[model samples]
Target chain A: MRISFSTTLMVCLTFVTLGCNDDQASVSLPESAKPLAVDATPYLVTTEPADTTPVGEARESLMDGESATLIGTIGGSSKPFIEGLAAFTIVDQKIPCCAAEEGCPTPWDYCCTQDQVKDNIATIKIVDESGSPVTADARQLFGISELSQVIVSGTAKRDDQGNLTLAASTIYVKP
Target chain B: MLLPWEYGVRNLARRPIHSGLTLFALTTVTLLIFVVVGFIRGLERSLAVSGDPNVMLVYSLTSEENIENSSISAQIPDLLAASLSATVKHFGITHHSPELYLGSRVTTADQSPGLGLVRGVTPTAPLVRRTVRMTEGTWPQPGEVMVGRLAATKLGVPTEVLKIGNQIEMEGQAWQISGTFAAEGASFESEIWCDLSDLQTATKRQDLSLVAMLLKDRTASSEVDLFCMERKDLELRAVRESEYYQTLQQHYRPVRILGWLIVGLVATAGIFAGLNLMYGALAGRIRELAMLQVLGYKRVAILVSVVQEGLVLASAASLIAGTFAVCWINGLTVRFTMGAFALRIDSLAILSGCAVGLLLGILGALPPALKALHASVAINLKAV
Candidate 1:
């Protein structure tokens, strides 16, 4: 079939435009940058798997220093990791960071010398998976800044004054 | 009582130089308007179609302008992403990639300086946004980079120059250029991408500038908004990708308005000049019109013929102007605040120019044509 000059020009232009778009669509991630498969078993925390009626009840059910998987969203900012447990809330015994006037710096920054440093630590109102409130100590464990999905494995402990705290020995992040 | 339009055409033909000059002036005005309007429309189209809607930009509330100024705790992204996944999953959001953007001057091994927008993106970013096309090599490795088409062109860097295994320095840190990409529009066509961690370390930014995520459904803007609002601690605003471009255009409103004002002022002058030209043509042929009047041609008929002459001139001028604009302005690249955009003299732009020309012709011819038609038939006959 014979095509006029203008028709041919238009055809070429259309091809060029489509070709440009197709070329752009093929951008690939570098082989080295591809995400590696993470072990989900290590990060699986079975504590209070189902939604509880209260927030802190999930933590109260755990025995002190007993291994329980804590499933929760990653908090703070940092590199992606499953084991990095920046912070978590236990049941009741929630100490408001404001009461840490005895030189407790914010948990984010540990300034032991400053009387008001402890005031900077975030205080969590511990509640069970059920609607009941429980007592727990707000413990700062691993520091992972970037928010991510995670499951932490740790032992639970209650401090003097009936404040429960989780001493995490091994933490896993669900990939 | 009818006067032939052929007489008006003949009058115009009699003084070819004056007709040519008037037509040229009209053409210039029409061309300028077409080019300016076309460019604005083209830029709007480019920006609207550039990026993916699924990509959300998470910048600091305190930091305005570029994302580079914003800083969050380095762990905030991972934490936020984890906490928000359930809500994001409820809305069917699949890919959430955090990006950190930093502007730095890059240099080749030979010390040639290249200005670039260095973006630190996740591996999944390319999967979410299909517009980013890589022409050669591969995506950036952990410490490697990928350059955009225009950036490569400007820096005179060949695809081969970015060896897959070689490192280049930017801000005293060495990074390898592992790939190259080109996009549909101009903005992304002039940038460079790298690994988020690599750029962060290079810039010494322990915190991410922003996080981008793609929604499984494009219509989930409201859902995303609700999710962000529910988590008052997150403190984010969700905007559609298209709406973001609209907001960007808002930044250029003053310049666009100024451009329109200039075109309007010039067009007004052209209209006046067109009116004078028509008046001169009619006055110079007063005897001819008068003879027609004495021969029983109605005054309205004479007026119609004069107006027809103006239309003919305008039609000719419109064609000339449209042709000039297409040849000179179409696809011509000009720099702007955001970046460079090519002039696009599409059908609408050309039609608007022609419409303006026609309107000018009618308005310019009305008074002169009426005056000629209103002259006394006897006086016209005497003059002839």
Candidate 2:
């Protein structure tokens, strides 16, 4: 009886150990994978087409795989200013840490502040005259910031840079 | 002046083999019960101690998994942090730190891969979690990282390997390792920390995974929960750290129940064996019992003596079992799903186990004792 009772006890303990081992394995993740990101949205557009262009005229031209005029805002940059067109958002930014003696004046030393844009990069997004969205590669595009408004007349096509290319014939900032 | 129990002990010694077997059975059961209870209690205590009441985990309202699948916008963290600080201050809370969490990998200087919970924390995070202590090195600098001891060990790196001057890469960004900390016996011991902004940029995450706050009084946990939930602007849940662990205990309930069920079944088998052993002792000793009755001893005295013998056996078994469990099982550490904890083996668990053994002894001996007491004096004397 004593032996049987002990055997039963050992069996129960073994089960408990197995259960715990399984749970431990499940809670941990793999080493190579990145942790889950909290942000849900992966894409955003900041530009709008020029107001003077005939709305359907750009849409119809792009429907036949032809060039169309488009305009949009420029968002992010590593540097303070750029002369050409690009697509980006105007956000207040700061670096979290700085090398200055009194500390950097920015809210953060590593990144810029949020909701305010300090500089202009000429990154533009082209939209059809009907205001429907068009896909564009952001790296090759140039001048859209929260502060500067621009009008451009160009032939829009998908470029090798992965941005919707508008070969600009006329470009001017809205005053 | 001799006590009845002393006489009973003398009688128990006369039948060494029978008494020893009964004692052994009781001892085995007692030890099992004590060890099992201690294991459960110890794990519960460890869980409670590790969880901080001030911290709240926010998972997706839809799925109960980690926060990765949750889709709250990136801007919500700043907005919620401002609101929580104001609300918590009204209840005497002075600081709140919001953290974004992602699970990431770290490779030591030797290139051994280690898994870590990458937490994106503000500088104020240390203030909110006072239990987290820096064992060596300074706090995290922007673009720099800190790692836990367990993670360090897993990566086969020295604690100083990730110190302030070292640089490590993650998500294509080279971050300097600035500090090391230990949260002793907590899940945090398995994590890595970095500046909130750097982690966000590295992982391309803009939303906060959860927010944790420190309160003025520990007892006001419920109030804080209510306060957070009452706000229409922030849809959130509040649970005390203790209560959260209690809920987590649900995960182990099935195991606990299975343990008890097995114990109960084994105990029943032990009781039956004890009953048979007691019956055998009575049957074989009928001539001795009859002689005692013929020698002018009262039937009740004989019955009392028999019951006393059983109690003596049980008490001896209880002592042996208790001693063995304490020496062998107490403080034994076992790793479980959450983490590792030690077997506590407190006084109460030991006492309860002994009590069960004593009760089984009485139950097994009672029937035979009563039957011997009711035998006719004349018949017993004739048989003798």
Top candidate on DockQ is 1
Top candidate by TM-score: 1
The DockQ scores of all candidates, in the order shown, are 0.03, 0.01
Interface RMSD of each: 12.6, 21.4
Error of 2 at A112 (Å): 44
lDDT score at residue B316, model 2, on the 0-100 scale: 81
Candidate No. with top lDDT: 1
lDDT of each: 0.59, 0.57
TM-score of chain B of each: 0.79, 0.68
Please provide TM-scores, in order, for all candidate models, with all chains considered together: 0.60, 0.51
Off by over 4 Å in 2: A1-175, B1-3, B50-60, B63-77, B86-94, B97-126, B130-208, B217-235, B250-263, B372-374, B377-384
| Total clashing pairs for each candidate | 65, 48
Model 1 chain A lowest lDDT segment of ten: A76-85
Tens digit of lDDT per residue, candidate 1, span A20-136? 432234465532234433232332344424322121443346565554545443221111112211234321112222235565333322223223322111112222334222221
- Indicate the DockQ of the complex predicted as candidate 1: 0.03
Q: Chain A structural similarity (TM-score) per candidate? A: 0.29, 0.29
Cα error, candidate 2, residue B248 (Å) = 2.7
